[model samples]
Target: MSQGKSLEHLKIVLTDIELATENFAEKYCIGSGGYGKVYKAQLEHFDSSNWSSKEGVNKYDLPKRRSTVAIKHIFNPEGKEGFITEIETLSSCKHDNIISLLGFCDEGPDHMILIYELASRGSLENYFESDDKMTYLTWVQRIKICLDIAHGLKYIHTNTDQDKQKIIHRDIKSANILLGDNWEAKIADFGLSKIHPADQEASTLNTHTIAGTNVYLDPEYKKYGRLNKKSDIYSFGVVLFEILTGRLAYDRIYTKVNKKGIAPIARHHFENGTLIEIIDHKIKEEAYGHVFALSKGPNKDSLDIFSEIAYRCLVETQAQRPTIDDVIHKLKKALQAQEKSQKENFKMSLEDIKSATQNFSDDNIVGRGSFGNVYKGVASHANGHTIIAAKRLDRRLFGHGETEYFRELDIPLKYKHENVIRLVGYCDDEIEKIILHEFASRGRLDGYLSDASLTWVMRLKICIDIASGLNFLHATDVNQEVVIHRDIKSSNILLFDDWKAKIAGFGLSLVCPVNKDIDYVIDDAAGTIGYSDPLYSKTHFLTKESDIFSLGAVLFDILCGKQSSIKLDDEHVFLPFLAKNRYQVGKLDELVFEGIKEQVDLQSFVTYARIAYQCLHHKRERRPKAGEVVIQLKRALEFKVS
Candidate 1:
């Protein structure tokens, strides 16, 4: 074999490989990102005979499996270290909750490709912005996503082989968390990850690199450029806040005159019981639990658990914060306790309820939420005439936590309330867990407002009823627990045949902290779209004021019969004008709900409108409490209605 003969043979092989690569790239390309292009590919299963006794490598197989893999081909002509590092880190890590790396390809100096199991559902970030994606993941599915991420982080921090180097995922934003076909979360993007030497136990690793999303990055890490496991903790805190509140970590800023407040401001408000103010409107409605009676007022136990866990995990000083293992332990224990309590509190079976509701006929459905479908049914214990609302948890949907639901509802059911919806009981067997509540026959206030048959007086009466119930929830003593509705939206305000309103849903709700976080709450966001408080959405702050803002939005929605955010239909080009005016301005009444001009008294309506406006005030300090809203509404009712 002469040198020229060897060269000739190599050239022939290279030509064939190049042709195969080109075909793969062209046929399978799906999407492109910063590092490379992703393609959904189908490769033939490699047999020993195929590799050893092949006349030539076969490109196609006789039979194909109904499976696909995502191929990320990195086109780095210069052979970049950063690109190589990302691929290497991801390839080395192996966790059930992290996307699996099937293989890698070093086709040429200019091209490096990594193969991973395809995520049919795509990134979690898609769900927030794309209407299609939002429709796909329901509230229950979102909670599972959060749990998956937590499990993945716990594995990275503690469950790995002790002899091996510990892993730290530097980037843990929503965009980096991918969803599989079943909506299971898979933490992706390990480009900035580091392998901590097994022996070293420093809070800050002396890494000469700084990497993470701008808003999600921990303040200490940003200031000192120090890398550690706690950095991932801080990032996860922001992710949790985002999930609970359904808002970006830093969409809006809260400042005092000239001083710039820190990002994740919800952390500051966590201890102060004001963290609820920062939750996303969508999450507020969805995660918003039912109101329960306590010695002082209404209470939301589930949200209290969420806020405590999230706050501890996101403590400003890494030394004080719980490790991922600690966080998981606490959450698992709390969840288990809740599940056990729910099992003990209930007596009736799903079959009995199904039979009572005539096999869950469509006519029986009385209410609905982001996670579960609701049905109206009768119970045998309360004589045949007593009607109860059965909320059936939809397991198929993505976005909410069923475990949290059971945990939050048990205690509330044991204690009855006059103004709050009475939880008669709940049923959790194998297929589903459903809550049975005393039915509010008139349905939600949202429907009342939407129905033209309801006059201005009816709407006003509904408004007063909501304020009174909220007032009961907020008014408390020094020794009594303070109840925060957490979610105060039009839909949650249910009405009876006589139009008397009762506040429902206390699962995502929480009891107020005696000593609340002054700046922010670190829990995952939970609420509805259009009605969420902007302050709570950005910072995960769950203040009573936050509820006031949401309540105000609901009031505004009812009065206007339109969305709160004013839109200029004719001026489709208000970007320049809006930019100049700080995106504020444009008369509230004129811009929104233009249809309500002659239908309602403008004077009486204006007073309620003003109350709603004050609730939505951006500053947490400026917004009135729920009690205050009730008082003011009472005053308005006396003046306008009388």
Candidate 2:
């Protein structure tokens, strides 16, 4: 193909650019700097495959779809390098966290422009600069934004898609990062980027030039000129501290005192254990703001992990800095830790609980478990009036004793996730103990197992949700103890109006703080009869695998569209036994629920069945972890019909 035919979709003429920007009017220019003015306009977006080639691809054949685009108009001779570098760099890179380069205009030396998808919220630098914008960003959102940048950087560093070019963005700063309408982060500005041979190692690059914002520049790259991916990592570490401190790299305070910026100051504070002193007051509010409201803040563990990694990234030696991959992993772990403890957990008055549930009336009872009865009630909250489930502990009944009641209440308060039930303040006053939970409008997951309306995809999603909850439960805390929900069952899984599932009933859970190396605890056999692990029951030992066994039984119940056990010919036949026998005989399809049998894809069925069967493995050591179950169930859901 000739030059005219090469990526014609990405070749916007100078006249079209001029017309869109109203001949480069002043008002249309959203920003201008050392590079050039950036103008926002509604321009035609040319789809890669869309064309009227019969018309020979003229200006008249431009695609009809209009979109908001940011056109970077470069006229300065000094800005030409960045314009060319950005064009080459963005064209080869493709990722969700990277800004999209849509079209470009290079008619002559004086007329050059590059168009990009408009980031509505503009560059991330704006957030930290304005107190009003900073207020909108919570600590949780900040962590996510950092994770997004780390993911994009990883893509650039690894180049696993066979691009055959090791691209490095030397200018890694908040100003170069753009934020979308929903605060989705995208890396931008590749003006000073370099393309090295893909086969070369990270430290192979030896350059005499030092470029990038001064405060965010790496000391190793500046002095020794050892430019590589680690240089980018150091700069990113500076940006990370900037986010944590809510201060710009070039803040007057830093420029006035340290000259090298917050990097050295952050390192000193982190080493001396006074890092929290420099933390942004606004974020400190979010981190410790657990007094009221459903909107919660960051967990201490998450902040510790995040701050430690950020501090590590800014180490003086290039070798001490972590790779982009390590940064991504640590960021994900921090997000999970924060999300687990991010919720409104408080205490409620007995009078308010009584008012919500009509003095614990029998008519108010919506669910009855071995522990007590759950009553649906309406309560006033800071946001507005909300419906809740007030689980009233019946002291008269031989159910979960005081110890178990406290344990059940503590779990939801401390560990919060979408898949795990949210606690809404508890009531404990002189034998009147009750736990409030977010009400499940659609009732229990067991009720809809056989319903044809509950499609296979929905069932698969519910399975994933419950498994995720179980996985979250198994995370070892400070005590190095794992939580084993010994009473996992279909009935224990509550389904919301939207068919979302959450694990409930933690009264029988065991927070076993055994030796770190031990996986099981020697305890009295305990759990629901049909769903209990046979190994635990026989040997008087409980393990996380016991919960896995129970989860397997629940999976089979959902598959077979019935309870854990069925009475056949005057004998109780367990679903696990029937499933195993049928599975071994190569007839597991016979066990699929009739309502969803036709809807289930063969691959999906096989994947789901294989994992569920693995969970039912008689040998405790053979059982798959809850995380593996989550992964397989998601894969099964993916294969389901769209």
In order of appearance, the predictions have TM-scores of 0.47, 0.58
Task: Quantify all predictions' global Cα lDDT against the true fold.
Answer: 0.61, 0.81
lDDT tens string, model 2, 1-642? 123454556778898888988899998999998667999987876643344352355655666455678999887977777877888788666676889888888788788899898887899999889988898777777887898888788878777766458778999999999986446688999879988867665544788778887888889888888888888999999989999999998888787888998998899999999988888888766732332344444567888899999998998788888988889889878877876565323667888788888887888899986667989888875656778899877887434377778877877775556798878778787768788888999998888878988888888888999998888677522222468888899888998988889998888777765336535556677788888999899987877899999999999998888888788689989888889889989999998889988898999999899999999999988898886688688778877854
TM-score of 2: 0.58
- Per-candidate RMSD, Å: 23.6, 12.4
Which parts of model 2 are misplaced by more than 4 Å?
1-345, 396-400, 476-481, 512-515
The weakest ten consecutive residues by lDDT in model 1 span 1-10
Give the C-alpha lDDT of model 1: 0.61
Can you write out model 1's per-residue Cα lDDT over 1-642, one digit (the tens) per residue? 122221111121223323434655666677776666787855422222113233343434322222256767677565355545655555445665887665455556655666566787788877766544464443334444666788788777664577666778888888888876446688887767776767876746765667778777766777777777788887887777666666555544433311322244766678677876875555444311232211121124545665577777677676777777776655554444434443354556777788768888999876666657889887664224567788887787423566556634653553234566767667776676777787888887766554667666666667777776665556422212356666677677788878787888776676654335423374876676556666677888767777777777777666666434436665443221222133146355453344445655656756666666777677877777665566566555655666
Worst lDDT 10-window in candidate 2: 287-296
- Top model number, TM-score: 2
